[model samples]
Target: MTGRLKDKVVLITGAASGIGEHTARLFASEGALVVISDINAAAGERLARELGMHFIAADVSKEEEVERAVSSTVGWHGRLDCMVNNAGMVGVVGSILETGAEDWRRTLSVLLDSVFFGIKHAGRQMRELGGGGVILSLSSLAGLVGGVGPQVYSVAKAGVIALTRGAASELSAYGIRVNAVAPGLVMTPLVEEVYGGHDAALRGGAAKSPLGSAAMPQEIAASLCYLASDEARHVSAHTLVIDSGVSAAGAGAAPQFHHQPADFLGRLPEQYQ
Candidate 1:
């Protein structure tokens, strides 16, 4: 039997590790013509070799690099059927006051700017190839709710959703679908860094989730696979959130402002004092 993504060309940015890596593996298992694009040339090329897929080094934050990645994919496979804008970083980790202009911009460059470039270049390629392709982005639960992530991280992820919706509206006419996946508390190396340690992050994520367990990278990968497949042929301009019900329960990993205003204001508000 043929796979869900049989013979389709897919370019996933940041395919070296974590969610992107898992997605690449899954996409290949489903018979996709996968191209692993990442700044980590060593890891990306290794994964490509393992899966018998292609690899291209590109920083998604830059427009020219993104265009080259898209063009290279087409040159190799003749078309790009799916473009997964999965490259990102946990940008601006400290309080908003501590965030300098350059620091904030750097974070946005990684998280939000990358998505914009991905949509632009991929949309162009799809349209130039006569239209009809899937564009999936990695949003986050913090984008929808308050207090789950650092200041700039949440802001950038939210921007991704808006970009997804706006792009979907524009691209749907050409049969290209744009969608985002927002995962709440996933246990990955990136999450480990944010929470300070791998085990601590796991414990915290599990404690905050109603399911009593944190989400794994594969779960998010599965959702992304669905979006990139023909099964979601009609799905676009939508942000499918996968949080295992944490968001619905009004639970968050951030400290309460009333109790810990220090996290926000770096001190008690004058009114409170």
Candidate 2:
């Protein structure tokens, strides 16, 4: 509504749903020329049509697809000002002993490798075309501390934070900024399914936050909008935590879940609370 990103060209991977979808909507609302990339071609195309933007089908786990997606955006828009590496999955969802090596690698391939590819390609493009671009990736509160998510997910998300910092150092000279967003307990479709539905998930997840609430995709999107815009020109290599103060709270300071009979749709991991 503010048109804070007026005329900026932004490419957001995994823009078909969740945080990526909301970010795409917010970016467009703020007057950015949005290009959404996702493996879900049907959803991506439909959303692009509604937003009057473009869609690129990309399985971000692969480097070539990531590179092509970036190139395709630059080809259509003539330039790129921001790259949102938001494609991810909550893969390998079991304990350490139950987790297989193949599953672990597969999860990392999607969650972590995709981000690295986005940075590598997008950073190169921005530099080649006179530099000066913003790169934002999705990390998580699980990455910030221990006992939050499953083993593999925490590792990958943590890698995103580290990658953001390292890339920022290298790309800042070219006027390019790299950052990551670490959010806690967002009520996304995936999370909804995991917790046996919206009410149960929201009740449990929100109980842990010091603010007595959880994050929504749109809220995370709003944060990304600010970071992608000129407002964050001086901000780089930062992992903006949008967790309702859950990360700030001490390990024991987190609230305990009080599940009523009707509310206990499924038991969430103790690690989460």
Candidate 3:
């Protein structure tokens, strides 16, 4: 209710749940005319009703649907102020050896291609409106390093980073800012399911980082809000990392200290050992 984004028009993909859902709610509270887009019609409609925002059922992987969603938002609000390309999936879980072409393509389509579509269409609308807009995509710590996620998922996220930078370079003249948020371990319902339950997911996430905790959806949402609001008017082409120091520590560097044995330093000098 701070009104940081007052009167702004925002569209969030995959906003039926997780980080997208949280960001949509946060944006709405701050006075943005929010549009919730997701393939989950049931949840999307329910959330739209709850927040008094419009809901569009669009599978972001398809260019046509993404185009329609953006057009619909602009048609309703007369301009698109912000586009959050937040839809994502873990995709095939195995290494490249076990991954199929279909799975790889699907992952890229959802995670990478969708961002391009959003930026392209939103940028067009913003150019027409003559007011600068912002584009934010959800990236991952896995994109910046290895072994943090499945190979294909990491690859798609890496593409998002590159897309953000390239688009920012080209779109800055029109007053549009392109950026991304690279989150490490976030405790959402999707992650809870993957870890078998909420408690287990929290424990697992906490064990991996220097902060001894994982980020909540709200934490990531706050970063999204800042990037979308006027407070970040000068920010562009940046991938804000909100990973509880996990990425800085190189993903689980803290755990290495816990796994060492008392005699692990046997080769060291006697006094040091």
Candidate 4:
């Protein structure tokens, strides 16, 4: 009854709630010696205790904190097998004109700079350990298209994808695999809060997808597990899209197209339907 990540030393940032929390639980269930890192000390400690994993209270945006997180994990486990840079926030919600410089910088620091820090430290650890490790990042469907999210948030996520590609290219030389997951509308706690409630969030999320449903946090977590596991040994520098076909349909594109009967074309007014 060996698990997919048996004995693997995995660290997940923002492991206190939502997708990060779910991923921590799933990784532990799969036999990883999970280490949970988050800015929420109380929730992170509680979850670590619940799952018998180590907890590190570190804001992923801080390079020093991020470096320490990786170092601490490696110190405890003797090697770092995987690092999931899942910490993020729905940055200031507004148009480009409405977004201030502070909001933009903070959003990028969390969503983009944090990944860079994680890759920098984790990549070094893996290389020092004699090669081989996985780095998974949380991108979004908004990163792939415009008008789906706040300007700052979208820009940050798009930067994550580009970072993933660039890091993967360089890290491959050291047996490290870098990849990202772009989820569409996942009904996490933050999302529910924004939409007012679970029902509203689900309804809104499902409306944007071709599947008629929003993704659960667990669904996105599952994708993380796959990327972290040995099954993805050959897969690198790839951003897996787990949007339930939303991206394929161009996010919010009309699901149905109108068709006119052959005889009805001329009956319609010019420039009108």
Model 3: lowest-lDDT 10 consecutive positions: 264-273
- Candidate models: Cα lDDT each: 0.86, 0.86, 0.86, 0.86
TM-score of each: 0.91, 0.91, 0.91, 0.91
Per-residue lDDT of 152 in model 4 = 70
Kindly list the per-residue Cα lDDT of model 2 for residues 1-273, writing each as its tens digit: 999999999999989989999999999999999999988899999999999999999988889999999999999989999999998877766566556677678778888999999999999999999959999999998899777777778899999999999999999999999999999889898888768899988997788778888678999999999999898999999999988876677544221121112122123222211
Show model 1 residue runs off by greater than 4 Å: 256-273
lDDT of 2: 0.86
List model 1 lDDT by residue over 2-115, tens digit each.
599999999999899899999999999998999999988889999999999889998777889999999999999999999999987765457676567876787788889999
What is the TM-score of candidate 1? 0.91
Model 4 lDDT per residue over 118-207, tens place: 999999999999859999999998899776776677888999999999999999999999999999889999889768899999998888
Q: Model 2 off-target regions past 4 Å?
A: 252-273
Model 2 compared with the native: what TM-score? 0.91
The alpha-carbon RMSD values of the candidates against the true structure, listed in the order shown, are: 6.3, 5.6, 10.4, 11.0
Clashing pairs in 4: none
Per-residue accuracy of model 3 over 1-273 as CA lDDT, tens digit each: 999999999999999999999999999999999999998889999999999999999888889999999999999999999999998776555646556687667668888998999999989999999999999999998888777776777899999999999999999999999999999989988788768899999998988779888779999999999999989999999999887777667763332222323222233223222
Worst 10 residues of 2 by lDDT: 256-265
